[model samples]
Target chain A: MTSQGVWTPEVVADLLLTAESSRTPVGSVTGRWPDFDLAAAYRTQDVGMKRRTARGERVVGVKLGLTSPAKQRQMQVDTPSVAWLTDAMELPPATVVPRSRLIHPRAEPEIVFVLGEELAGPGVTAARAMHAVSAVLGGIEIIDSRYSGFRFTLPDVIADNNSSSRYVTGSVQVNPDGFDLALEGCLLEVDGQVVDSATGAAVLGNPAHALAFAANQLAERGHALQPGWVVLTGGLTEAVPLAPGSHIAAHFSHLGSVVIKAD
Target chain B: MPTGLAGQHDSRTAVLNAEAAERLLAAYAGGEPAEPVIERHPAADVSDAYAIQRAQVVRWIAAGDQVAGYKVGLTSRAMQLQSNVDQPDYGHLMRSMFAPEHVPIPATMFIQPRVEPEVAFVLSRPLRGPGVTIADAVCAIDCLLPALEIIDSRIRDWRITIVDTIADNASSGAVVLGGRPVSPRAIDLRLAGCVLYRNGEIAATGVGGAVLGSPLNSLTWLANTLGPLGVTLEAGHVVLTGSMTRATPVAPGDRVSASFAGLGSVSVQFAPEQQEAAR
Candidate 1:
């Protein structure tokens, strides 16, 4: 076996412990392996961190970011990236957070799906991915870069878990067949003031499309959707920044609403 | 007691070892270039790539995957030449990536997540065939709403070729909708303005006309583009034509607002982290 094959759960656990204890941003580890593939770096990094979680850390839903066309152009890429989620980063709906913990953070309204079975790739199709879903809910994803300037290239961000920080989901589920998801209104409010607005259709025209795209993407990489996997699908609106004493609300037209507070 | 280490590399359980090699090769030598590489091939072959991609998509759909919808890319002229493509290309959006409300998302979700102002269209009628006009596209719309598109890139350092991105679905990402829903005939979409703000501060600005000189133009082009493929946009689908302006990054504890002139306004906020702050 190659030296890289020496990676083990213990190694991953220790790395997560080190990162958490030292609070060292993964960016600092960059030159340590200059030839490391960015995507592989992310998976390797997660392997270490995930090892800790497997020992008792709660697994939260995965975080989906880069749900914008302009961003894809800016990054010179055509596909979005994803990261693992853990319960340690979850916040209740309308929960207020402190402003000082993040270097840069933004919140976006997104449609979340819970898988009823494992969805994996190679031959995974959009219909198969949808069939694996058990429920759908409205949620807000908070993205933050541990990097100081919030100016990472695509590789930097990928290694940083796509800058996923915290997520808050509302308590509602709509069967995949129930609503016209592609065309639903989404209203976001801050401090009782309407700040941003759009519709579910804005995301590649509908949230379901994001699923199809993601499913194809994972399949291309030989990964399939597994049961119980919660995919963040793409964002349904523009991302808003987070600040203290701010209240955010997302009204998903027919689906329902999600509320959060920053204190 | 074990056998020789030779050829043992094939028995490794790590998925990364095998995948990384292929990804690296594809990145460097395969048809998929990691960055823009000028190939002196005929224009016909360049265009043929689109057909090839379409065939691949059809195979997947026939394999039991549904065509959830379509994503229109390079609607802007600037984006057209940036990737060295003379025209725009399309990709499929599936159902597996859809997200629902109340699900907490970790911050490390995307490669380079950013938000752009947009306008979304829900068609009341189907659009098909050539000779489709902007007026036809507009007439088919059910409602129009202000939208924020969260775009991300899958390539490292956000470096990619247009063909690579086209295969990746135009880098389409998350989308947020707000503002009031207005009928297609309500106002002059071209004259509309889209002003975006972060933390109550103006971050980026744009106008509807920026989207291929009126969002309807995007649909018109999209319809014509799809006609050759025997694809027609069905009713009840949302069409996000393109962005009205540049995208901006969002942060936690921050609020974002987008104002579309003559339509209405919308907003959202990100939660804060007291624990990290308490440290």
Candidate 2:
């Protein structure tokens, strides 16, 4: 340890900055933040970034990340991770993005819920998270990172907002009542080619459960996902990569389809 | 205010102000650069971070930008480990992020780009309530399909604090869905195999098990998680489970394909840079 026997913020920042600059994974950054434990380092970095966001004046949304079993298994954890959101990043349906500025871009069709009320911990359940949702709809998530070459560790990934980028939705916004997410199926098409099919069950059995898990997780952190907040359940299927001048469409067996194009 | 001709005003100062505002908005949208701002105010308190983010969101919405939806990240074990979190995080998506299918990618739009194979789901009924079960979730789905997600990021050197990512929408880039659908009950999703082919060669191969062992299980977890949060899974919505296999990167001129057992397959052709430039 340094003479103080405690990790210093400068050390943590410098290590993190090096990792980011080098486009190395979080595992590598760990080597630099010797005194700063991985999780503790994350918490410290989180606090610093949160302070920055607050100083700039932004609105906080629910924390995201931690919806994939593969991720959990890889991380050797049972629960998912999350990051706060501000109002500024919200986009409308069918928004177009330039391909050049993004570090690495990919897309996923997801079920999004907009909460009507705030829910907290103490018995946070999947069903309860569902009840808090005001509407559910089909959406496309465009995931991007600020890191060049898109290299980072799990810790780095979470710290980077789970690599969240942009999103678009379909016109049909419906009240999530009596929906059978698992049994439903979807067809993803690129141009006119028929490729890829799956069911809602692919997303951690049911997407509602993912949302519920996120809600309770947030509650444990003393941060409640308020009403009117938006929650994106895990992806129903694997993510699709993007290219310029491409047409991406998702047609659900019952939910209809949402389409977008790269310009 | 001093009554001065519009042209006579300090155009440079006004320009600087506008530029500063734009940066502020972007910082608000994403996270502020870890570097200290010129004014050098004391560091912000963590508790107040959300408030500031929310206010900026309101301003963006008021500016006529559409509220597309949201994105969940760090939900996967790999990501959680990489990010050093036990749970997932989330962010919002805007309309400006959408890209069409089969469109040639312009290399200039992204600092870097990569692709992943996935499955997308569409719901037929709403799945809500705190006690929603797997069976209940099963009954709510309409169809599922093979898909691809293009993940990109905006941070320089990919170095960003967590809050920086939170403001950036989880580094989401674009999405492409295949033209096929199937029922969840008809196949063994957990055992299903996914083969990712790049340029007619196997670059990566995995199974449904890779994605939490059956994408449905992921959804079930999501439902349970959201139940207490007052959220629900509605009909006519879509969900993207985590990757069924390891993420394999693709480049221009690379033709990619993913085949799933019983569910079907999807593919995309990366165009030549010159061809993309022509577009």
Top lDDT hit: 1
lDDT, candidates in the order shown = 0.62, 0.59
lDDT tens digits by residue: candidate 2, A1-263 = 23334455445445443443454433433334444444664564556456547558364454345555555666666666666555544566666655554545777777677888987776777788788888877777777654445555565565555666566767777777887665455556666443344555556656777777777766665677788777777665567777787788766544557787766
Per-residue error at A69 for model 2, in Å? 2.8
Q: Second chain only: TM-score per model?
A: 0.72, 0.71
Best prediction by TM-score: 1
Q: Where does candidate 1 stray beyond 4 Å?
A: A1-34, A98-101, A216-223, B1-279
TM-score of each: 0.46, 0.45
Position B226, candidate 2: lDDT: 55
